[model samples]
Target: MKRTLSAAALVLLAVVALPTAANALEGDSYGPGSCNSITPASVARGAAVSYSCSDFWVANQTVSITIDSSAAGVSARTLSTVADAAGDIQVSIDTAADPAGTYTLTATQGTVTDSSDFTVLDPADAAAAAASASDPSAGGNALADTGFAGTALPWVAGGLLAVGAAALGTVVVRRRQQA
Candidate 1:
């Protein structure tokens, strides 16, 4: 039993450590940036966002950052820059001119690609906001708030009861058999 447990522990340790090793080996491709992340996932309309991406294998390679907007009035924009030594690039995007909506930003070098989503929210209206705050049911619907309204709750409760009864019956049967 001790040997078996030791073997199992070793297997578990290997399973956990393998992913970290694999991830460390997986750096940027010869074409695309490797380590990339964006800060502040959502923001007000027309705000600046910061992003960093690394292309360790492809040092000094040019990368293109493209911004695609859902709003029709605004056209997609692209910016290009070369990565620094150690394959790192840092940039800020100016959203102030973009319309309020979701935008996808993609960075590409050759065949490698990484993308992030950003949100721009519209400013709230004063009178409409005031009316909703004053009225208890103004902004939100009662039916939607309940989530599992109508017959759903009842069916869920009945299902729980059935499961409980089956578990109780199994316990009782096992006890009678032991007795």
Candidate 2:
């Protein structure tokens, strides 16, 4: 009976612990407080991209905008603007003038900063890319480096734990009958 109880307890612990495997989708490579975001998330090649921030540490503060492009010929660029009296600032980028690829857009005010990923692709390529990013077979979360989107290992473990418990129960009953 003690052995059966121990086995049941182990199965309960495993079921509770399996769900935590999904925690891998939490943060990004930049640690935290990288920046806010770029509006629209993505844009076609030769289009425009916009971004805003309202969490500046101070009003009328100067925030720097930096674009680090992955496309060839188009190098990294940095620009600056001042936040309004309400600590909000809006800026736009002429993607039409830039190359086609992914770019990292970061905004900085004083030591506080935020960053977002902006993609510039041809219209024809955008749909396929979007489909693949959302498709589970093609490495789900392809566009995002972190966040909980495509993890199934936890559920698999939970199922396995249930099977093991059932098998253990069967074995316990058989042993009790023999005794």
Best by lDDT: 2
lDDT of 1 by residue, 12-123 (tens): 5755586567676555443444555666666655667877875532578898989898788878999987888877888898877877788898888888777888776654
Clashing pairs in 2: 25-147, 34-113, 34-114, 34-115, 35-114, 35-115, 46-96
Off by over 4 Å in 2: 1-36, 127-179
Name the best candidate (by TM-score): 1
Could you tally the backbone clashes for each prediction? Answer: 1, 7
| Shift in Å, residue 22, candidate 2 | 23
Candidate 1 wrongly placed segments (more than 4 Å): 1-34, 55-57, 123-179
| Per-candidate RMSD, Å | 11.1, 8.5
Candidate 1 C-alpha error for residue 9, in Å? 9.6
Please, what is the TM-score per model?
Answer: 0.53, 0.51
lDDT of 2 by residue, 72-151 (tens): 78888999998778677788888877667889987777788778898888877877877877988986674556666657
